[model samples]
Target: MCDLMPAAQPAEKIGKMKKLRRTLSESFSRIGDCQGSDSLIKPLDTIPEDRKVQRTQSGFDPFEKPAGQVKRVHSENNACINAKSSSSGKESPKLRRHSSPSSPTSPKFGKADSYEKLEKLGEGSYATVYKGKSKVNGKLVALKVIRLQEEEGTPFTAIREASLLKGLKHTNIVLLHDIIHTKETLTLVFEYVHTDLCQYMDKHPGGLHPDNVRLFLFQLLRGLSYTHQRYILHRDLKPQNLLISDTGELKLADFGLARAKSVPSHTYSNEVVTLWYRPPDVLLGSTDYSTCLDMWGVGCIFVEMIQGVAAFPGMKDIQDQLERIFLVLGTPSEETWPGVHSLPHFKPDRFTVYSPKKLRQAWNKLGYVDHAEELASRFLQCFPKNRLSAQAALHHEYFSHLPPRLWELPDMSSIFTVPSIKLQPESGDSIQVCSKSKATSNSKH
Candidate 1:
């Protein structure tokens, strides 16, 4: 009877082993049943009865193997699990889904508390300019705070301006010190410049001093040349965008409309540059432009600096602007501009055939300085290709009187650093004061 009892216990043990194996196979079947389970997981009937009794007494999981054999069993189980997960339809519900890398980390070196805004300098369509002082080093800065749109986030203009300014390091280009980004706003920190050319001109209106004009134009060209050499075009070049330091250092600013030109030129938007400073070619509905597009604006600014008034201050539309330009530079024809007839806006009968007037006649102040009219003519060419390049204009006879070393200075060095080169005082008072005096004199007469 004792021997029969032993035999009955073996049958009972085998039945328990079969039940454990079936449970394991059913649990892993969802993960494409572990292929090695048949060999790795053994029935208790195969183990020595004494060892089985010891494992059961130890309270170890029935499905787990000894510690020494545990690693291999888990590895085989993982292989089948991974295979099932790789199939689109067989993904395990227990699999964890990891997220992608987060957006670009915030600037490590710059923070909002680094600068304190003192006063509001100005406001524009998308941003507000404030005069700021650095909390870390006690230096002044111009903080341009651009509001982020709920739907759009950061404006492309701000991104474009920052990316371009980061690579451009020169005495004539505005320096971008740091950028502070937040959930509600994006702030661009810049070296604080006292005033811009437009405000400076308003302070002393009857034309800037010839020496001052020369200095400003030189700096403008210097900056333009640097950008042009790198295939960049400052699509907008107005007096308001040119910042003037207290020491008369002219730095180009507001590059929101600027873009890099490729080797094979592509058509660009024609609706750039203020009407008063826009070039004839662009005003004539021409989209294919180059660095010359900016040269025309440079010429207009040059004339305005010498004359104290916009060269073509059109009060109306594109036609009025073109008419103002034609009145001075004469209406263009195939003889003057080989492609004039092909321009979208050009119509022979639509424009008056006015003979070209000498630049000195239109802006008498150009006649006040030697070589000034000639340089003005070179820039105000009716044909886009005929305009002088910023680099070439820098070497023109109009700038010949400047110190020879001005041409040889390093890219980041200011021309003011040259000995004896300084800003000359203006001869006239502010425009308002001059206007009041003129009105009083006329009333007395």
Candidate 2:
């Protein structure tokens, strides 16, 4: 929203602080509320399908097409998650993984005793992650322990997480370290990140300074841009999925809900992202989706970063979620969104005629201008096709206008101030980096 520049004088700093506080107060007050319904039950994400695979006689897996600079397939049947650098084999840890004996993807049997579980990081419906240390090289890793259900072999989501991860490599994405399999359970080892963006925000409370927000948003778009180029949809892009290390680098994580896009058809699942970050097209039941799915999420995350609250925190109901969104952005019509009426779930009675509102009005209400207004306009587009692409967003005027010093430092040196740093935008001085060595370290990030 506001640029948090470190002014030279205390009086200037106080004035800036006053301006920021006033802006926040007025923005929250200025919003026009649309009425919402009370409902507490909705599936925020997709349930795993048995994911029937149409395996070719050539043993060519549909999920293994890796594009870009480099691609690696850990195994045909056993896809793995590894840090991108680790994918190059130079950084990949030497380890064995547990696997289903009967599966053709199974490798020669390996022992799971090579790693020691330290503590639990978090748990989800399909898997639980632990802080683990590898005995082979004493490297710390986040071990994702997936529970094997009786009826289903391994959930398709886990397969997607492992396989898709092994093939792709990028700095802003979480690194897959090792996949250790035992007869009873399967463990996915990832390059450990100390905390996620959600926790980072919690530590900062109120909200991060605008400069940091810009840095983070830039990294996020950069990462998403890479994924979209690879033709994979993250599907989920909430704060919890963005990982941050001690040196202040951002990485995208949690591919369990992610899926690769298909040519000719894009229909996947209506239920994919966390309800708060789910895009309007998905909410309206348009399964023929594309990278716009993630762009919409980037918009929600942008708003959350600016305001320190969810843009649309619909608890459980799809209707409630839409209510929160349309309340602020206004309801969409076929006129605003072409072929919107053709969505499978679109019904004549579902929406009432509501006039559109300018996103700038809200930004003005918050006293933000320029890039925030422009980027917000691009990201919050009602029609999915109209949303800005991640690659384009990175080069948007908002980011282009920034001074060189702002993005280079591992951390913003001071309230947006840099010491003895002067480089031209054309100087070819680029500074986006990830410390693979320290990514998994717990050393005071």
Candidate 3:
């Protein structure tokens, strides 16, 4: 029995030795694949207890590998150490790059302690206008506060107006000083104008002289020209919307209905402007129109200024509006207005004419007799194509005799005072006066 046991022990020992050698060989090959070398020294001279145990269990040696393999493993191990060092070093600077502070995306509209709320000026579809003084600048400014608790229509309109007015910078357009957005309210700060054309005409009573009328019309045209050039359409143009300063400078206000013109055939919904100033094309259901629609309004305003009343004040219905327009300017035919028949709402049967004698009588009532007959005729033309441009009218012989300096009026900064509203340090409230700033900042990405 002892002899048999000794023989079995020798066979078992030999088999165990062969298995250990094969395992060591396989471990060396795997270490080579991982680019680890036996001869490569570790960063620390002493091995950790866990590492020593792993080496003993895996049967790894530190000096038996080929020189080429050792060099390859050393290069790979160095690269890994260098990569770890580079990664740790760069992390903080990369984090710091994005940590730099930036200005808030949008300014707060109204801070509670900013402006001293004054009396209410007026109320529109969107907001209630107020006369307020800015605590910071100590200037009096018009404040428009919008209540968002109501229907969304007015708030949206106010936002659009604020967005557009923020970028517009012209003599004839109203200036937007600051915008305040509170928890449930939006407020707009504007430069205060003395009165609008409606009130101005009412106060004058006798109607502006033809020369003054011409001057006002010229300024109105200039404002319109600027707006049109910027691809903006002042959908509502009337005496009410035309604000006049104390020095009689005219400014186009109320951009709730105003829109930038880009596409060719964008049809706005019906009933944009007041009936009296609405053009023939607008009344004929022509939605896809051009700046020519505004020209028609210009003609209306011109005639209203000259006559001391609306030129074509129509009744409630569209047909009545059409008839009133034709009554004053005479009916338009295919020959008179080349595309008259093609209009969306064109109906030849509804055409009629008031007495020419009565029409002339109305013109005389408006005090247009002293001016050149051709001037009135040109302005009163029914066709949008025939209407005078703001620039052309400025150069008309009517204004030629006036001083050239009349066109270059006093600086706006001198005439009007802008009020600065104070804001809390963390409130992020500020005013953007120029249109360009408003456009770039307010536009959504």
Candidate 4:
């Protein structure tokens, strides 16, 4: 798996490069919006034109959570990838490079020549990821090569991502190893993970094993809790953004849209998270939000893992997305959500109000598992403030069956470090084999 060719020969290198280029052509297109398997459900039915909700012109949304002031803290224990910024302003994007003595295992700072690109993995609007090997330590790493625009020096998103990631060091979060800056590009070296949750689900469809699902969900919440406690909001939480190691470790990746919630009064862009996983409050034009902005996506992902399909796979625009969510969770009213009438896009007459359905009613798999529906319902609340915090959800009855010592692990320690805690074989193995066999049979024609 390490070397694509038997040995380095000129002809073989050319062949390998050609083959890699071909593979890259057929690989994931959008790095930020990483593509995976097709949705397991049909495209949602579009809303009637008569009931179509009008779009709003609000610049950005606001999240008003009162938290302590962010303080500048330096650590000598370990050095992170790159960049540091003290200001959490929603508009200004400026970060200074910070360096420290990294753990003996990691490299301090890497130049362009420090790593060798092996193959292209994915390409996004701003960056292209390559499967790379570090020349210094001879370790595999993910190289996120971001091209610099002539007009803008360094992309603000890249600056924000680096600044936030530099301060975050957790087992469940993807580790940034080194930063390689060049005149034309900024390459961020990250610990290469085997696959993401989106691709993992594609391999084993029709729902994952109950044990495996539990483990994945636990690790996800563990990661989120760490970030939320630090006042950092991972605005995007889709399965593609979640990296899954071959050892079944889940690490949150792609901090391009993440923000540190230091200023409660600051309003953020409403066009942040992907449409499918976006919360309803944001869709309703409520810019002011809190940490619960991410909790809604957590519920959607939870249901998707259980049912083997998206909870609400809207095909059209924001209104269509809202309709799919409202169809299940019911329409929000003044009684359901206070200040609902004050939002920029809430039109009471435009929507047909229906009572909220139970979580099991929408996702049948939840009914089969004990305490699963209750926990999901806690996260899928229509009101922004009603969603359960990641920290509180970790101690819910749903996770009670897990080992008690799991709660005692350090921030950098994985739950798998505990004895007898590992991912179970996916229950859909038979289905996976059948699908592969069918595909192979069809290919012969």
Candidate 5:
């Protein structure tokens, strides 16, 4: 009986063990079937048993790996962990690696506390001028503030001016000291001249003496020669643009129309110089003109200074201007200007009878010359090529017997030496006077 009881117990133990094993195998099979047949089950079952065990040991949810292991898995995963840690912890968001707004590359003007704005000087098509002083340096400078919002072309004009001025060092040209660019404005800091040739001539009233004219013209030619040597052309050369220092020195100002002449394939339009000072070639529709254009302006200025009025002031329209020119210089024929017949607007047969005696009488009437015949003969040349160059005109016998030092004009020391001159508001009275002179000069031309 004892032997039979031991055998039965063994049989019972084997049956229980087999049933337990069968139950686990069926559960695993069911789990595999659910995972293979359903996407949800597959995703949920992706977690490895070891990772689940680690999560459980670390008190983390078993659906995800432990935080440390997940962070170590990939750079993006690590970044996510760090972000979460920073957010939950007492740390602020990480700063990005970017350039600071206050870096030196940013544009800023004179220290706000130092520069004091003075009165407005002049307003042009693109900018306004003011006279300001630096409290820090106690220096007076012409402050040209450009309205970036209103200017149409590329801001590179200012950049080019600054860059060009940086390389140029000349006494006869305006000096640029500093450049300031803000988000909305561009400022050019320059050495200011107290007066321009037009203003000085106005103040003098009777017009410059022949000797004074010689000196001014000499300096003008010298400045132009220097500019031309540097491959720069002052496209706009007029009396108003020529700044005269209190010391009697002449310095060319307003480089907005200046350009480096070395560029290839360049052909400038004829409308650059003011109409009164424009050359005939320009009027005839020539674009590939050279330094000779500037010579024509110098000639006009020469005559104006001598006569106290514009030499060749034209009419309102091109036809009127042409008539005025022919009336003064006499109708240009193929004899005087070989190429005049071939000009784009040539009208040789449309001659207006020129009375040389009447023109001479008019020159005398205007008090333009003591010897009207000699002066008129020299000045009334019709062709631009026949006109005198600035340098050649400087050496003319007109200045031969003048004082040894022709440059010694009154208050000569103050001419261009002013560090800064405050720009005053233009009085309507002064403008009227200037306009009147301009008109009279045009009629005479």
Candidate 6:
């Protein structure tokens, strides 16, 4: 009976070992299923700081990265920030990271501040201009507050203007000091000028003195020369866009429509410049315009300065504009202009054969010299290629000496030094005049 008991104990021990082996095998099988479930069981905070800030394998520039995609950034020893998954597939949700000060999306520097509105300068379809002073620096500035639209958050005109102005630094061009972004609108802060040429003309009832006119034109040509050198087109070059400082410094402004010249394959719009200042080529629908396009406007300005009226004030439509132009410069043909007939707006029947007036006729009729007309003629060439470039125009004989080498005008150097003379708003009349001028640029237009 004792021998039988000992054998039974060994058999009992073997049965116990078999039961323990079964439990252990089941636990190992469950552990094999928990391979990808590491994240589900482990908290994100437990991840090593180095592991959370790993570089992404998604090859893309951080600045140009599209939204929704996980942009793995090296966070500064922060916990793992897992990106939410819309629908996770075979792979787990990707982790994302963000910039820390040294990133490209960081804030850039600028100088913008509160300004007391001294007077309203001008208003356009997109913005309102006011003469203002900086609260921080006490510097005068022209504040242009642009109206924002929902469809296009900020207009490309404002964006392009800022971009171009950032690179362009010349005394002749308007200085864009700062661009302020607000929740509702964009503000362009420009260096303040007392008034533009149009307002200045209004102030001077009769006209600018001949010496002043000569000085102004010389400055205009000089500025235009700088602009052309940079391959930029000031598509709008009317008197209203020319800002004049109190000390007689002229700067080109209102670059809303200006664009860098297009490559040879593309063409720009022709209906940009005001009809009166629009060149013959542009009016005739030439899209491949170059720097000479502005020269035509310069010619018209020369005439307007002399006559105190728009030279070719076209009545209703483009046809009328062409008629006005041809009335003064004569109708074009293959003889006068080789490819005149090939222009998009060219129609032989629409043109009438009109003999051109001598350009010097305006200068001569207004008691000025032949050189004024000579300069005007060079700018008013029927063919754009034949027109004088801004650089060439500056070197023309007209600028070589003072006005009236057709000998009746004053000295040019004297007017160049003329200080900005602003009239102090008096008891009532001066205020009234300023108020009228400030009544939105739309009213003036």
The numbered model that scores best in TM-score is 4
Over 54-142, each residue of candidate 1 has an lDDT whose tens digit, in order, gives 10111111222233322110111011011111122322222222122243432122455556666555455566666656554455666
Predicted candidate 2, C-alpha RMSD? 20.6
Give the C-alpha lDDT of model 1: 0.65
Model 4 scores a TM of: 0.74
Candidate 2's clash total is 12
Off by over 4 Å in 6: 1-113, 262-265, 362-367, 402-444
Ordered list by lDDT, greatest first: 1, 4, 2, 6, 3, 5
For model 2, give the 10-residue run with minimal summed lDDT.
29-38
Q: Residue 225's C-alpha lDDT in candidate 5?
A: 65
Error of 2 at 126 (Å): 2.4
Which regions of candidate 2 fall more than 4 Å away from where they truly are? 1-111, 263-266, 360-366, 403-445
Please, what is the whole-model Cα lDDT of each candidate in the order they appear? 0.65, 0.55, 0.51, 0.64, 0.48, 0.55
For residue 118, model 4's alpha carbon misses the true position, in angstroms, by 1.1
Off by over 4 Å in 3: 1-112, 149-154, 353-361, 365-376, 406-445
TM-score computed on alpha carbons, candidate 3: 0.63
Compared with the true structure, what per-residue lDDT tens digits does model 2 show for residues 221-260?
Answer: 8777767777778887877678765545677887876766
Residue 113 error, candidate 2, Å: 2.0
| Residue 431, model 1, lDDT | 40
Q: What does each candidate score in C-alpha RMSD? A: 32.1, 20.6, 34.9, 16.8, 36.6, 28.7
Task: Report the CA-based lDDT of candidate 2 relative to the real structure.
Answer: 0.55
How do the residues 248-278 of candidate 6 rate in per-residue lDDT, one tens digit apiece?
6677787766765332313467766776688
Give the per-residue Cα lDDT of candidate 1 at 24. 29
Cand. 3 Cα-lDDT: 0.51
TM-score of each: 0.72, 0.66, 0.63, 0.74, 0.60, 0.65
